[model samples]
Target: MASLSFVNVCKTYKNGLTVVKDFNLDIKDREFLILVGPSGCGKSMTLRMIAGLEDITSGELWIDGQLMNMTSPQSRDLSMVFQSYALYPHLTVYQNMAFGLKVHKVPKDEIEKRVGRAAEILHISHLLDRKPSALSGGQKQRVAIGSVIVRQPKAYLMDEPLSNLDAKLRSQMRVELAKIHRELGATIIYVTHDQVEAMTLGTRIVVMNSGVIQQAASPNDIYENPVNKFVAGFIGSPSMNFFPVWVARRGEKICLEFGKNKLIANEICSKRLVEDGYVGRRVYLGIRPEDFHEEGPEEQKILFDVEMKEVLGAEILFHGRINREEICVRLSPNVKAEPGERLPVYVDMDRIKLFDMDTEQNIIYV
Candidate 1:
């Protein structure tokens, strides 16, 4: 296994359009790191740069201990699994898995041993003789991964390898991929647009937007303590509810006022806001869908007319509007509520997030 580093790396076109800017990261050996963001966010480009498939306009790329800014793709000693799977339709799974080694003149017996081990690890040992044309989407994906595993590269680069699979298959593949990582103890750098994949498979995730990294941290930190509004809103499924609230002081306590409703701020939040001189300023109040409670005293409640309800088996998502801004609340599936019905919702004040109205940066952490 080998560690990788990107030091002030950048990519720019001749037209002066920069797709990646001053990107820097250190990936530990045997770590599963995921780079995630929306489309056109430069994640794929960054992966390609690491693989030597894209040129770094500036800065250095290092693998293990050596600088590899000018290294060729085949000389990088890394394996990349593309979104397309890139399987050879004319070759059987066994031949496809053996192709890389065969080109390097690995002994026939050694080649068979490596391929067999990889196939067993991926649970595709029985499909070795079948051609790509005869394989299912999930099966073909495994074969692609198996081919890379046989080479025993220093690190694995996966670019949305499960994007083509159906939703159910993608979920199953995520589990399988996690198991594969454990079995091999390999260093992997995976890029994807799926937050679920990032949250579930990554030991650490890098969230990117517009060629800049929004945050790089463990899944829990990224979800619960996002550095900015973009990171908080991007990492969660239902996103976060942002309300334009007024900060006010009442006696020794601070409160956030939303329309006619008021939520008492916690001690920490109050101190920070008072010290920052935001007692009468407007800020964005962020609350996750799951943080809204239905069981609270009337004084703590904020009434909303339910606009819609989505039944998602274990939970019911109630969609509503507050001052023309949309908000969603995730409740127990057994909770009875319907559209056009009025519901009183309370927020977990301690779990709420506060962001600067002008900068959109988390003020609580600042």
Candidate 2:
């Protein structure tokens, strides 16, 4: 229900350590935007700035067309949920959820109506009489969220709200959060270090590193067309495999050669390499684990020395070496292969990515 804009925003400490560098982004109304990166990557710091918990060193912070850089947290009219539940231990679920409205002196009947609606939306109606001590971890989290829901703020800010729960609870909460987003149609800004959460929950993802924005795109674009080596290696589960290979011309064909092996490039990749005059130079060959296939043209096969295997239900991940460089391949579970065996696999030419050796940027996208 609200839109936010950060125009050339920055955050720096008194000790002169800058955490956010010229950050600029526009968040649309009713959007679920995720800020994702590793620890100390400025994701949480960015969220704090929006919540009025941190001062912006420079630039503008606007909310629904109002300048908010000088605004107090209370006047921001935004609700924030933290990793800790922070519920009052002595208050019942209904009382805890109604506390905020009571402090603001809302009508008693109106408070009751809001609490009932929130509890129903969160599926915690039956637990309204229970105290924080008697609720499960997930239920406690729901109560914390319900407290914010009653406020009905313009936007919601969440900083890893599900991180404190167990893995199973985290997965369950993920589904619950998705449903809440749809039902409320409220704008949400979420921050987390978990890529799975970023991929599944976000309508738009912003990837950051060292106080800089690396890439901002949808899940499919980030997975299929990463902007650089760091993103290509970070977004996926098993991560993309990298190899130092030479781009060379062999007769009338363009091929990538590493050690004693060679693989042909698809027409699109080959055209870029030649047009960019990289005929005889070193480049990084990037391939995802799932792009390796057990069936392909015989001439495109390479001997992969399997060192270990992990069976993950529907598929198997083979951790092996190709010409002394470590590699991981995800294949169908039906494919039979064992440790210490030479297994031949082919790379999907059309699905492969190439990166610049010096700049580390994706060559195809550059």
Tens-digit lDDT string for candidate 2 (1-366) = 799999999999999999999898999999999999889989999999999999989999999999999999989999889888889999999999999899889999999999999999898999999999999989999999999989999899999899999999999899988999998998999999889999999998989988888898988899889999988998999999999999999988899999878998888999999998888999999999999999999757878899999999999999999987999999999999999999999889889999999999999984
Question: Residue 251 of model 1: what lDDT?
Answer: 81
**Per-residue lDDT of model 1, residues 17-106, tens digit only:** 999999989999999999999999999999999899999999999999999999998898889898999999999999999998998789
Runs off by more than 4 Å, candidate 2: none
- Runs of candidate 1 with Cα error greater than 4 angstroms are none
Candidate lDDT (C-alpha), each = 0.92, 0.92
Candidate 1: the clashing residue pairs are none
Taking all chains together, the TM-score of candidate 1 against the true structure is: 0.98
The number of the candidate with the highest TM-score is 1
Q: What is the TM-score of each candidate against the true structure?
A: 0.98, 0.96
Residue 301's lDDT in candidate 2: 82
Candidate 2 TM-score, true structure as reference: 0.96
Candidate 1: worst-modelled 10 consecutive residues by lDDT: 296-305
